[model samples]
Target: MRNDVRALRLSGGLSQAELAGAMGVSRQTVNAIETGRYSPSLTLAVRLARYFERTVEEVFHVDCD
Candidate 1:
């Protein structure tokens, strides 16, 4: 999976720690998501999208290989 989490966070003027606090996750979790080392669950994805006021597709994409 690929996501624009870092871009979105930066565009919103938020640091990873701030995003994690808003999403109820740890900073490392947000970092992992931004770096593509981890994929979020469906529930978490929805939460993130809701927080960013975007659709899930706008934030994440399937990387067809």
Candidate 2:
């Protein structure tokens, strides 16, 4: 999976920690997601999309093999 999280966060003037705080997750978790080291759960993905005023499809893209 790939996401525009870093770009969105930067455009929104939010640090990883700030984004994490808004999503109620650890900064490390946010970092992991942004870096593609981890994939967020369905619930977290929805929360993230809602926070950015976007749909999940706008925030995340699944790369097909």
RMSD of each: 1.0, 0.8
Give the alpha-carbon lDDT of every model. 0.94, 0.95
TM-score of model 2 vs. true structure: 0.95
Give one digit per residue, the lDDT tens place, for model 2 in 1-65.
89999999999999999999999999999999999999999999999999999999999999887
Specify the poorest-scoring 10-residue window by lDDT in model 2: 1-10
TM-score, per-candidate, Cα-based:
0.94, 0.95
Candidate 2 Cα misplacement greater than 4 A, ranges: none
Which regions in candidate 1 have their CA more than 4 angstroms from the true location? none
Residue-wise lDDT of candidate 1 within 1-65, one digit each (tens)? Answer: 89988999999999999999999999999999999999999999989988999999999998787
In order, how many clashes per candidate?
0, 0
> Judged by lDDT against the true structure, how good is candidate 2?
0.95
